[model samples]
Target: MTIETDRLRDLVAAELGRARDRTTLLTESVDEGDLIRQHSPLMSPLVWDLAHVGNQEELWLVRDVGGREPVRRDIDELYDAFKHPRRDRPQLPLLGPGEARRYVATVRDKALDVLSRSRLDGTPLVDQGFAFGMIVQHEQQHDETMLATHQLRTGAPVLEAPPPPAPAVPVTGEALIPAGPFTMGTSTEPWALDNERPAHQVIVPAFHIDRALVTNGQYAAFIDDGGYDDPRWWSEAGWAHRQSAGLVAPQHWSRDGDGWASTSFGRTQRIVADEPVVHVCFHEAAAYAAWAGKRLPTEAEWEKAARLDPATGRSRRFPWGDDPPAAEHANLGQRHLRPAPAGAYPMGVSPWGVHQLIGDVWEWTSTDFHGYPGFAPFPYREYSEVFFGPEYKVLRGGSFGTDRSACRGTFRNWDYPIRRQIFSGFRCARDA
Candidate 1:
């Protein structure tokens, strides 16, 4: 289906608006001190994220695609993510929240002007609003980062969204994904990131994956069985990290009387047993899998369960179908501050009846972050190419913090094995 110039422009504009709205919502509630404070060394300050969002938009949309002069040219180095490390961001001469907001607003105005006049076809960057889409996705990605910063910030709750609907009925057992070759990734998704490009065929052996994400209640059982205490379940490196960090349970979790409570945003509440476990690093997930006599699904296995429709023998844009995400489809776009109960969103299940494959928590896969057979970086190499190695592990699907534009079956998320501050989780898979 060819996208017309007007439709493409509208889509770009709408996505840009949504990205800005989410960014504002995430940052505006906090005071200036909160915005400038470095909540965690691993993350940039909120104000830095705020300005960086605009700086990136300006780079891709106004400067690169529009072929226009730079606005606030000198600040480029200050906001250059690759140039400056997260820990050093607090020492830079950063823009205040008011100035940062104005800068982004000005950049957005100019970008929209470019969108209105520029042709949507010619080069890969301009075709299908690729640059525009990239900018929107970049901003949304920062929005997610800001949300993570909020999670790390020590203060009263500054964000809130109503809980998602309860599951109609719990999906009690694993779903059997048939053994076969299915199309993985995509060569056709217009807005797909570079890593998810060039669709390919993958043959997965028969396997049983959980119908829903592993719940807090289930993980608590692992804890009760001394999953963390015993070194047998953890890898050598994982055990070392666990001991060094003194990790007792998932980050932000603690014993509240006889039960457990978790801190979200800033409020501490009793752990919801039915909800998918969040904040567990790859090690924890791997350990939990070991405790249960299961294993983390390979990236290919996760993609097959998510995108491949056995009947059609093709990969859909999302798990449910080729439709954009809806409220009932998944918990995404910061619509909820927490993951809904596992087994919810039956409508979001894949063709093979794998539930909640698209949202709730980004499920960790037992695969290293690597490129495909025909992998080639477009626009820039730093986005995905720089990080393809054994140092990072792959994560599939999206979490509650993910924007719909950035969430898809083929979208690849990876991180160092030890990092767990993001909204990450896992499910167990076993051979059939």
Candidate 2:
């Protein structure tokens, strides 16, 4: 179901407030020169990401079609996130930081009005709901990017203050859901993204999924048991990927005493075994599942189980009910700058009694990342076609470093098997 106008407006205001807090904190005590520096190969200059805080919201919700134009002509010349990925973003206009901030403020004003006044739920001004969803998700995404820029450029308060002394509670539960004639894609609803659409039907049989993600401890078991060395566990592609990565364990993990642990933000901590595994690629997930006699569920099966309508609620835009993410829901976001323990978000659980499905990490599906039967590539043809070769795999649900608005139960993303970073992770499933 779609969120109503008033509620959507309220959400917009709240998101703007959060964004302002982060932006203000990030920009304080910073030289203008540093804001323009590209911090990492994966990131953009702070100025571009800052402008996008307004650019993305306006692109779809205001300037594109949702509202009357706020800025004058040639907006794209000033801010177009699609023109380049963050790493190569063009410098912000030559205006002083104050004037630039004012320009950004105008864009936000336009977005606020559009989101507040537009009739979006049923007959959206734009034909596809994604146009709006993209804006929301983009803002949420910038919240994280803003934080990352602050951390990389300057040692900002990236971590939560009075941070919990204890680490995440390890996840440990498993559920074997009995599957049937389950709908595999979006339900009959107005405004679903095309990638999630043309609602189709599929049958999934009984299967078991870990109650939470495979934790650092569990993966450590795989390592102690020679999980990484055993080529038999790896898919042909997985083996090649691991060799290329030169990985013996998760990217950030380290051995602490007899057990394994991981570090983030320069803090060394013990690993939690009950949590789902993170920083793994499709190759590693596949290998681990094979070793454990489990398998990565197909997108259909994973979605089916997640759509299970237990007492908590119905199949929502997320495994949780139809609300945007919160810090308590999952280890999402820059709220904590690291993954919360898996299974921590029972409130966000799907009908299947799964935990942390929404936030901790994006789970890999067995299926290749392909278009649906009636899939039509809109907006840009190259987006879905250029990556259609045999190299990529589909990942569903959102990951920790993800934009909340861009993500949905049905949003699709993919990566080559060899890449690993803070954002990727996996869950395990098996045939019943």
Candidate 2 TM-score to native: 0.79
Q: Flag regions of model 2 displaced more than 4 Å.
A: 1-11, 16-34, 66-100, 114-132, 145-157, 161-173, 187-191, 255-259, 310-329, 376-390, 400-407
Candidate 2: 10-residue stretch with minimal lDDT? 161-170
Q: Alpha-carbon error at 67 in model 2, in Å?
A: 7.0
Global lDDT of model 1: 0.90
Q: Against the true structure, what is each candidate's TM-score? A: 0.98, 0.79
Tens digits of per-residue lDDT for model 2 on 142-182? 65566555544434333443331233344466787885665
**What local distance difference test score does each model get?**
0.90, 0.66
